[model samples]
Target: MLTSIWQAVRRAVRPFAAAVVTALLGVVLLSGWLDAVDWPASGGWVRAHLPALAFFAVAFAFAVQGIGRVVRADRPARSRPVGLSWWVVVLAAAIVVVAVTGATEWLLAEADHATDRGAARVDAIKTGLGVGAGTAGIFALLLAVRRQIHQEHTAADTVLDATEKRVTELYTKAADQLGSGNAAVRLAGLYALARLADNHADQAETVLNVICAYLRMPHGRLSPEVSDRHESELQEAQVRLTAQRILGDRLQRFSQNPTWGGQVDLTGAHVAGIDLDFAGLSYARLDGATLIRASLQYADLSSASLVEADLSHAKLTRADLEDADLTDANLAHADLQGADLTDAKLTRADFTGARLPDGMEFRNGLVVRT
Candidate 1:
C-alpha cells in the first residue's frame, strides 16, 4: 500500500515538473536574446543576483496564482478585480524578497572573515535590511513622479487640442463673413481676421494674404454720380479702405506690436486713396498696381518692385525708395519730396509734373541726380 501511494503521487507531479523544465528552457533562450541585445538589466546587480531574482520571480508567480484561485473559489461567479490593494501587496512582497536576498548575500560574505559568526550574521542582516528598504522607497518615489509627469503631459495635450479646434472654428466663421453681401458684414470679417492674426502670430501672413487678395479683386472707384451702382461702389470702397487700414496699422514702423515682416503681394491691386503712411513695406511687390492719390508718406518701400505701376498724385514724401525698381512706372504729379531714391531704377518711368527731391530731376523720361 505504501509503494502504490508513492507511485500515485509521482504520477500526479510528473506533468507539473515537465512544465517547469520547459518554462526554464524558455527563460534561458530569452536571456540569451536579451544578452545579445545588450539589455541593461542583463548585467550589473541583476546578473550578480540572478539566482535570487529567479527565485523571487517563481515565488511571486506562485503566490499570485494561489491568491487568484482562492478569490475565484470564494466568488464563484463574479470576477475578482485587481486594484491598488493588489499592487500594494505585490510591492510589499518584492521588498521582502529583496531584503531577504540581500541579508543572505551579506551573511555569506561575512561568514568567511567572521571571528564570531553569530554577531557578524546579525550585523549583516540589519545592514542589508536597511539598505533594501531605502532602495525600495526611492524606487516607489520615482514611480510616483513618473506617473505625475504622464498625467500632466496628457492634460496639456488635451488643452492644446481644444485650443486648436477653437481657432479653426473662428477662422472658418471669419472667412465666411468675408463672402457676405453686406458691406458691414465684410468689414466685420476683416476686423475679426485682424484680431485673430494679432492674437496668433503664426496666422498673420495668411490674414494679410486674404486681405490683399480682396483688394486685388475688381472694384470700381467711388463715384460721385448718384445711382444704385454708385451707392454699391461707395460701400465697396469703404470696405476696401478698412482692409487697407488694418494692413497699415499692423505694418507701421516703430509700432509697439508684432509686425508682419513678410513681403506684401499687392500685385495688380487697385487701391485708390488708400492710407498706408509710415508703413514698413520693404520688398513689397506692387507691380502693375494702381495707387492714385494713395497716402504713402514716410513709408519704407526699399527694394520694392513697382514696374508699370500707376501712382499718379500719390503721396510718397520722405519715403525710403532705396534699390526700388520703378521701371516704366507712372509717377505723374506724385510727391517725391525728401524721398530717398538711392540706387532706384527709373528707366522709362514717367515722372511728368511730379515733385522731385532737391538736386533730383526727371529729364528725358529718366530720373537723374544733379
Candidate 2:
C-alpha cells in the first residue's frame, strides 16, 4: 500500500517537476549565462529585460505542457479540467501587476528626470494595478467563452451519437422484417427501409442495395393452374411488384419525388413486364434477366449491362443507352426511337421489328446504316 501511494505521488508530481526544470533551463538560456563566448552587449540586453524574459520563460514552459497534453493521444484534453486553477490565475495576475508597476515607475522617473520615490511613483502603481486587473478580467472572459463553446460541442456530439444509434436500430429491425414469411410484413419492411433511406441520405445506397438484393432472390411466376401454390406465387408476385415500384419511384429522374442516383445491381433478376420509365438506372446490371415488355421509356441506362436479357416488345423511347452492353439481348419489337446508343454493344442481339434510332438499322444482328 505504501509503495502504491508513493507511485501515485510520483506520477502526480512528475509533470510539475518537468515544467519547473523546463522553465529554469529557459531562464538560464535567456540570461546568456551558458554562452561559450560571452558578449558584453548581449549581457547588457539580458540584464535590461530580465523581468520580462523571466515571465516569458514561465509562459513558454506552460505552453510546452499544454502542447504535450494536446498531442498525447493516450489521454484526451477533454478528460481533464480546462483552464488554470484560481490560485494560478491569481498568481499570474499578481506577477503582471508587479511588473507593470515597476516598469511604469521606471518610465516616469526616466521621463521626468526625477527620483523614483514620490507621488508620481504611487500614481504609476495605481495605473499599473488598474491595467493589470482589466487585462486579467479580459482573459477570464475569454476562458469562460472557450469553456462554453467546448460544452456546446460536447452536447452536440452526444446528440449526434444518440441519433446514429437510433438510426442503426431502425435499420437492423427493418432488415430483419424483410425476411419475414408473411408477405404483408415483408412489404412493410420494404417501405420502412425506403422511409429510412429517404430521411438519411448517407444510408440511401445501402438501403437500395438491400432492396436490389431482395429483388434478385428467386421467386416463382404466377401459374395458370388454380391451387395453393398458385395463390402463394400470386402473393409473392405482389410483394415483388411492390419492391419494383419502390425502386422505380426512387430511380425516376423526372419525378418530383426524391431520386436515388446510385448504381443498381439487378443481375439475373427476373422482373418481367416491369415499368421503370424515366428511371435513372445508370450502370445497372441486368445480365441474363427476363424483362420482356418492360416499359423503360426515357430511362437513363447509360453504361448498363443487359447481356442476354429478354426485352421483347419493351418500350424504350428516347432512352440513354450510351456505353451499354446488350450482347445477345432480345429486343424484338422494342422501341429505340430517339434513344442514344453511342458506344453500345449490339453484337448478335435480336432487334427484329424494333424501332431503331435514326440513321441506324439492324443488319446481321448489329446496328448499321439504313
Q: Which stretches of candidate 2 lie over 4 Å from their true place?
A: 1-123, 223-230, 256-259
Candidate 1 runs further than 4 Å off: 1-127, 224-230
The 10-residue segment of model 2 with minimum total lDDT is 34-43
What pairs collide in candidate 1?
none
TM-score, prediction 2: 0.71
Over the stretch 83-157, how does candidate 2's per-residue lDDT look in tens digits? 656545555555565455445544454335446457665776677667677767777887888788878878988
TM-score per model over all chains: 0.68, 0.71
In angstroms, how far off is 229's CA in candidate 1? 3.3
> For model 1, how many clashes?
0
lDDT for 350 (candidate 1): 94
